[model samples]
Target: MYSTHLSPMQTYLVSENLKKMVSEDWRREKLHSNIAYFKTKMKNANRTVMPSGSAIQPIWIGDEKVALSVSEQLKQKGIWLTAIRYPTVAKGAARLRLTLTTDHTHDDIDFLVKSLVECTYD
Candidate 1:
């Protein structure tokens, strides 16, 4: 028995569009490449890039106060990043989480890296 269900139209649309979605392999490769680029650039800017097994990379910013400050600054620059702390992560591990998506372009990644560096310094 099905525990969940989708309407007939939903099922048909999902089936038809499944192949159009980004492939798992492509997403993995792109995520790794972007993470590597950010790691290097952020390190140069004195920011920490927390290692992760998935596309979500947490950039430690010392504490919640700093994380929030950085998040707001980045937001002002048109970059929306979430600040993670407390219940989400341990105290003193406050960070800004960056998620890489298949829809993001290399230039987009570059802009993020540049913006991050600028924001941290400013």
Candidate 2:
């Protein structure tokens, strides 16, 4: 029912972008580049981002209270990082999810890293 009955507009959009979505050029240029950019920025900031080969990198906060507090702080700063908690992870293993995309520029990443550092230290 999902793929079998996409609306006409949905079909049009997907068909139009399908080639780019699966293209090697897109992956090598956009996806891989953004991932590298984000990881490098995080590492340079000395933030503990778990090694993830994809767009979503997890920064472990370990304590649920700290994770939730940081999540709120980032939210107030206009960044939306969800605090992952127990049941999703073992107790004492909370984290903040950092997602990067081709739409994000280096400046954006820099500001995010700065904000993160500030939020954690404040």
Candidate 3:
């Protein structure tokens, strides 16, 4: 997914390769291991400081929608959001991106967090 953000067209392109990699036994195993590592890292990180929308899983909305929405949000403000989307996942599985980092204000997070929460249930 990080690879998707490296270039604009990468997601549309790499998704094909990603499917191929998963089809291969060895590659699939390696990918699973890598995913586990990152999942653990993301899960274990202290996210208390992050805004509500910045948490993992349920709060996130996947890459395409996330990228589009984040772009709109940033244009109004000035923060960049990173999203994790499907094809990299099984169908129907997607995430809304959030991060607990050193560079945001409560107010900055306030709008985003509020909006994301509203969007989720909607």
Candidate 4:
């Protein structure tokens, strides 16, 4: 038997409550803070963090081999990231793209940045 769910009115009320819990100001601040943290980490590692109007930022690694290896290494560390390679991008324009979301905490960003730095060096 299918479980009963909230009525339309109940659903609307729950949605409204969720909206009130997360304000636009709070979301914007969190996103900006996360991006700033990432930028600082990349800078300290002597890596370039590309600016984007979107939430995803690409850190150019240049070589496809390096990018792939780094992606795998980061995965082993439990930080999942994708290596943007040829066809999707020009040859020798490979990168590791990171997405910043309001749900991510400062510690989460730090771990990712540290893992990236360590993996690149490895």
**Alpha-carbon TM-score of each model against the true structure:** 0.70, 0.78, 0.36, 0.76
lDDT of 3 at 80: 51
Residue-level lDDT tens digits of model 2 in 9-67: 98899888866776656655876787787778878888888879877889978899999
Segments in model 4 whose C-alpha atoms lie over 4 Å from true places: 1-23, 120-122
Instruction: For residues 1-122, write the lDDT of model 1, one tens digit per residue.
Output: 53225789999998887667556577668777777776777777676788886677878776788789889989998999998888767898888888876677778877887887777522
- Superposition TM-score, candidate 4 onto the true structure: 0.76
User: 93-121 in candidate 3: lDDT tens per residue?
Assistant: 44445543333344555655444433322
lDDT of 1 at 70: 85
Regarding TM-score, does 3 or 4 come out ahead?
A: 4
What are the candidates' C-alpha RMSDs?
Answer: 6.5, 5.4, 11.9, 8.0
Best by TM-score: 2
Candidate 2: 10-residue stretch with minimal lDDT: 1-10
**How many clashes show up per model?**
0, 0, 7, 0
Better of 3 and 4 by lDDT: 4
Q: Candidate 2: give its CA RMSD in angstroms.
A: 5.4
Each model's lDDT comes to 0.77, 0.83, 0.46, 0.82
RMSD of 1: 6.5
